[model samples]
Target: MKKDQLYREDYFTCPIYFMDKPEWVKKLNKASDLYIKKAQKNNQPNIKERTKKFGNKGDHGMVHHSTSLINDPKFIDLQEWILATAYNLLDEQGFDLKGYQLFLTEMWVQEFSHLGGGHHTLHTHWNGHMSGFYFLKGSERTSCPVFEDPRPGRQMNLLPEKDKSKVSLATSQIHYKVKPGRLIFFNSYMPHLYTVDNGYEPFRFIHWNIQAIPKGVLNINKE
Candidate 1:
């Protein structure tokens, strides 16, 4: 009885989900090409320098952002899938979503500059309840997502790890090996960032955030 009472139970754990959907890559990538082109302003034939990056690096180290994909017909199927998954995930996690509807609050595609040095700093999507990524292009030679441990208290008095390669509770972060059509979902509060890309290979992904709004909170169709 004493031993049973002393057993440990997991709580406040973070969850991350990923799966491959190769069939969606080709069409989605084709649909997103125009958006990326417009973002980089490369469609103008007369413009020698397309876009500008910070440090006057000539677009070498910057990332291009696309407008919302919410109203795009090409991304409709993906939107449906994401909405269903988010709804199920929250329900499974013990959230009471009875009086709420999941909304695709934000959706967009972004690509790193081809001239190299593209990267993003650590950040969280606090505005939404859940967020995810769907890779349209990537490989071993390209940059990938890095997620940090969500619990800040654990980092305050961390101990040295025996081996950095092996993941243990002491591990502060995890690097996700990315590939085309690989979709990843995580809590909105999770801190994540992308590693710097040398531009040896193309890296592009669709990122979106979902918010659960109470019934009748907003006059919009629920996903």
Candidate 2:
């Protein structure tokens, strides 16, 4: 006889994992601090207006600056590690990435200060094939990551028994708490928003963007 099970389909929002590299994590934290200090000293713009397109639903602090990895030694190292980690996860998940191009673009630093909570929004990275973020540092009150509703009102069509089980309700868009060293990946189009941060004191966090370029469109071949 077969063992009993409720459902066999192990659905997930996306492939996400926490990379275990203590030294690298430390290095990233240090680098983030340096960047934050520099940003504080510069004439940073009012992020409230700049981040409007990304999401303006809640209160959040953000600092934006773009630079190439080749120009920054610290960022170069972080970029390499991120790519390696992403590649390894995709391999384990049996994702076919042949003839694909990987491009690291739009690198920036974001700092969430006191009562700096984020709104429900998604990053609109043009032609972004795959994107994600690495939490350099965060307080216990960090915001939660919420997945958008993929299918609405579809649950009503299910049979009475299926509706009564509450499985579908649970599967409907879920929320995840952000933590240090935790990296989450998702399709560029997926809608996501950050919930309110609870801690009273100021907090800090840094994240960057990763883009993938399909091989055929680009003139160069994969290295």
Clashes of each: 0, 1
lDDT of each: 0.89, 0.56
What range of 10 consecutive residues in model 1 has the weakest lDDT sum?
46-55
lDDT of 1 at 202: 91
lDDT of 1 by residue, 175-204 (tens): 999999899999899999999998999999
Q: Who wins the TM-score comparison? A: 1
Error of 1 at 25 (Å): 0.3
Query: Model 2, which residues run further than 4 Å from truth?
Result: 1-13, 19-22, 41-71, 91-95, 118-126, 151-169, 198-202, 220-223
- State how far residue 147 of model 1 sits from its true place (Å): 0.5
Off by over 4 Å in 1: 2-6, 42-57, 219-223
